[model samples]
Target chain A: MGAIQGFEIRRSSASLRGSATQLRTLPVVAKYIDTSTCIGCKACEVACQEWNDLPVSQTEQVGTYQTMPSLQASYWNLIQFREVDYQGGVAWLMRKDQCMHCADPGCLAACPAPGAIVQYQNGIVDVDPEKCIGCGLCEPGCPFDVPRYSERTNKMAKCTLCVDRVEVGLEPACVKACPTGCLQFGDKDTLLAYGKHRVTALKEGGFAEAAVYDPPGVGGTSVITVLRHGDHPEWYGLPKDPTVPVAVSLWKRILHPLGFIAMGAALFGTLGHFMTVGPKKPKDTSTTSGGEV
Target chain B: MSDASVPASAHPAAPGPSIMRLAVHREDVAVGDEIVRHRLLSRVIHWVVALFFMVALLTGMPIYSPVFGWMATLFGGLSVCRWLHAWSGIAFSVASAVMVLHWLSDMKLVPHDLKFNLVQYMQFSAAEDPEIGKYNPGQKLFFWTIPLVTLMVLLSGIPLWWPTKFGSTLRQVCIIVHDVGFIMWFVAIVGHVYLGTAAEPGTFRSMTRGTVTKAWARLHHPKWFRDVTGDRKE
Candidate 1:
């Protein structure tokens, strides 16, 4: 009986081994933004909706021209209208909100579903509708909360950085729709240089806090920002100093696989040991009974 | 019952029996001589996790940027790598979820597991720690975190893929959550891989072969060894 069981265990283990030897590679693309020339028209928002064919949101007068309340499953991009006190006059802060398409995107790392969320060769975050189960796990992992889950479709949706357009060598709809040359798309190097020059020109024109917004945090965003004020990134609804959660790192690096291995070994070991060894031999009792005659 | 009446030493001293019957260690629990452990299904499920996880990590790096874009060369080119990375990520998540369901019963934190502060297991002195069992407290902690991290990655990745559809505020939030979660996951998986493949010498074999030597069981799991071997005395 023990031999048969042992052979069976070995046979099963051999058959179960799988080849998980595939290596992954990524693309080289840049997501650039030129905030110097933004007119705060929110044309990018309109363009994004029209091009993507998204439903229009019934936004009320929220005291600001910034209409859409927040990032939702349907609205991918929004131009935030902030009324900032600059020196003496109230300067209208019109910042376009969308995926920064970080050089090191957190969404890609956090996503478990392959193709559900991906980065293109041009460095844009893209999603696969078919693979998404709308588990809503990636929502909390994002430092920027870029991905939104649609209850209707039961899948998360967000910006694709116009990967389709970029693939065909065309500018994104939002960039093209901008009447004021505010949103610019190009290679990362050129965009960085342009952003720096723009910042210099803005600061020279007496906009003191006109600094670039792409800190080394979040592995540096492809979409660079030149804010009108510098009080806080959070004041503009951005995290002050974003860092990946410790729990995620712990799980990715150690807990998940190790746990699986340990559990597998333990379960198998216990079962195997039990089946082969059977029950412990009954304690010796003949001597105590004095059965010898 | 009749066999129980015989003196243990006398039975082994029978003249016909060899003085030293080389003890055959059963692969499963030995009933005289027997062994059993993981069947094929369990081991296959385990390796599925190991394989997809690596693929997910490799493909994911290039998507993160040029710094790791060189990684793309491994998969063919940047374009192919793009779709591959996302798909592999999904595969890893699904496989891991299956693993979670398979091991949920055993991984539940029992009272005995709670007695030992898990932090202590990370220390160098843990090798000698008596409380350590077939699965240490640290291992249990790592097991539980897998589902949590997988869930985070999946949810945050959605808006990133189709940002135009999600609201602006939510997109912003997803960015933050996704980045933060990735860093944490990167660090944790590194440590986990180290422990499973390198930290323990005999462990990888258990996952691969689905069998451990009797000696290994005795050294690592004394109570289990005793119960299996039915040895009550020295």
Candidate 2:
């Protein structure tokens, strides 16, 4: 369940050198969600909470069918219910919201704590609570806005893609509990082929903009969805094109190495100056006691 | 005067006057041929700033990069360092603020200071301009850089401490600000320490014992040497 040796870690957040050597022996896994078929019944959400043993959070009457506005620290999964004007009438767009677990995970890239966030060979991104220092870098690092900071534990929490279950050859709890055949899990390549076929079927069935939601900016995600209106992903509470934030990218890529160089230069510059120029001393004191005032 | 091993209490005039001296009065004074560059109060504030700055640096470096992760062990762990860095950072900021306010008048750049070239100063070929005051222009520049960098770190750090209070965009900006500010501050401190100790022979005692020899004062700060000693002879 924890730090399974069977799965090779592809990346470890803030690792000094690099993460464990990726064998790439495991097939990349993914979840296929046909959002067009979802009936807005949040069985997946309940299954996630139950399997993970997350504490129940209080929900207020927000005058909407949605249980809550967004995912919380304890509530790792959510079913976003967005009402949009479609086909000249109001239509409900229900999306099962959770971590995308990107191929190039921003949360992992932005994290400064060693082993706080990790991506396994099977493409599962997980946060280790014990290692998380809760600096909240992951909050801004995520392009999909998945990670939630737990004030109680002083750490960041997010959907682990159910690594505990996946390790035992079991499908994620949410995927297993889905009743409408809307959610399916398997190898990433196989799921993408299935999702694309569904998208083609939707396009032929009068939805012209139907497309597979596998954003290439993030190198694609483990959770690929077939959206009826993929042209307007914002309608489904997803970014049209999501990439790691430029600030985070620059900070991790450029600044980290530059900082070391800058500090080294300061040390060497001072040392070089001292070695050549020597210490400044009074000229007339050479003949005297050298200590004479 | 060269004996750094001499304790602060050994200075006959060091203990009494500064105890009752008001904060408004300048601490720079002379006793016989020895000049008091920093008073007891000034020395205390200076050390407090140094101590807290070191604490902040040690705690923050671990969080900045995993290469220094071992540093977290010195202060319990990474989680402990998270809060310790913030609190120590605040202490360093406040101490720096007090330092800036206390030395503002002395640090103001005059027309002569405008000609102070850093490249020329590093050569160490000639004596100080004789017109130079309590601190050289280079030292004053470093003094002013302290609060500028501290304010950047402090302002950016507040948003980081309570991430939920601020937006993601602001938080990202603060991350950059905090890291860049830290690098600049660290480099400046490195140069400061060098200049305060090894770069100048007698400079360390000014902070340690709050005094410098008349020769040290005359060589480093000639104009202030005249002001303190009333010695018109160059």
Candidate 3:
């Protein structure tokens, strides 16, 4: 029994070490939107607005059945329509538009307000209302043009991928509302595998650009898309290359800390001298010591 | 002009008004007015900046997430939050711009200040350099960055507000530019808050009271103290 116990202790120590090393190699979750299977159903769009309680958008007929024209403050999600010629056959391409919830979200990176926008542990992008400061810095950073500024509230608004619901083991409102079995959410690895499988299946069915739209750039989007035609990603209004600007990184990594340190030092040093020295004394007082003159 | 006419004690007497020797320092100099705390105008501007910042934040939260969708109730609803966020952003940018203009004169980077890099200043162990002055290099840098970052935010926000009005490529470029600018601005402001409040003891008073003690002035800005007091002490 003693010998067996000693062997077990040795084995457990080895396993603990291995576990520690494994902990350091946490996998980065890649979120994506699969466009290949997405039908032109407006379920995702309706679900987004309804759950968020966003006001109905006032849109006009602009030669297409697409409502609300484009994404707006009240319209967090929109089903985009693009008529493209695929092998001489006109196909109406559909995509649900919202914040990409990117791994390297430009919106989170650009927001001037601390905690105004943040990326959650599960790779969902969220906004902190208390810290937003209505600077609208996140609006342009998104390649998808996800954020919309509200004039009335003087703040920026966008889809948060139902971060609250996702955290508590619930599907996003839009994902749940998707009746066509088009929108699916799962573990990133599983999703990637499933997306790949779908893409292979679509390619066999004669869709050429039936590949994945999750690029390594922009640190890879959390929302991945498996599109029917690769060429049509742009047509659906997705950027080929999304990246955090070098200027921003330089400012954050170098300039900001430097400014804080320098300023802090100057403030402290100057104040410290004044408190200690009091006022300047006469040169003759050097010999006075602690005694009164 | 006529040093010979003055008594020998006058030289030593000039450095009086020391808090340590109350009668000595207080005899000649009045130590200026009971340090004028932030005047009405300064207070107004400061509070306005703060108020607009809060307004912007509340309105912006719902747009970022449905979790904060509860924040939408503050502004009637999420639709209201959306519109409020954009307009409030404009308000913030404008307020920041006005602040820059208000403090422009004080914030100038003089030639003497060029030697005062933030890195060297942060080395707390070093003897306080006499070259330090009112509003050190770091404060100046912060003041300058506010306007530049505000400009970046405004420029990037415009295209996003109306994407179709701008070409798709231009909009993409704007998004990148805007996002990068916000990140940089956010980090800087964090440091600014720390320094303005908890980092330094008497620093917050400069913004609030609008006046600093003679000792504080002399210690932090020896040159300014000397200039104000006309005392020359090695």
Best by lDDT: 2
Model 3 chain A — which ten-residue stretch has the worst lDDT? Answer: A5-14
DockQ-sorted candidate list, best first: 2, 3, 1
Error of 3 at A269 (Å): 8.3
Q: What is the CAPRI rating of model 3's predicted complex?
A: incorrect
Cα error, candidate 1, residue A141 (Å): 1.4
The fnat scores of all predictions, in order, read 0.00, 0.78, 0.04
Clashing pairs in 2: none
Candidate 2's error at B219, in angstroms?
1.1
- The parts of candidate 2 lying over 4 Å away from their true place are A16-24, A286-293, B1-26
Off by over 4 Å in 1: A1-28, A268-293, B1-234
Candidate 3 lDDT over residue span A1-293, tens digit each: 01111011111100111112222332334445667667677888788878888877787676666776778877888878878776687777777887777777767765655456665455666665655655455654666667776766666777777766665667788889887677777677888888889888998998866877876767677677888877657877777676665544444456545644654665565466445433232223332243321
All candidates: TM-score of chain A? 0.79, 0.94, 0.75
B165 Cα displacement, candidate 1 (Å): 18
For model 2, the local distance difference test gives 0.85
Write the residue-wise lDDT of candidate 2 on B50-94 in tens digits. 999999999999999888989999999999899999999999999
Better of 1 and 2 by DockQ: 2
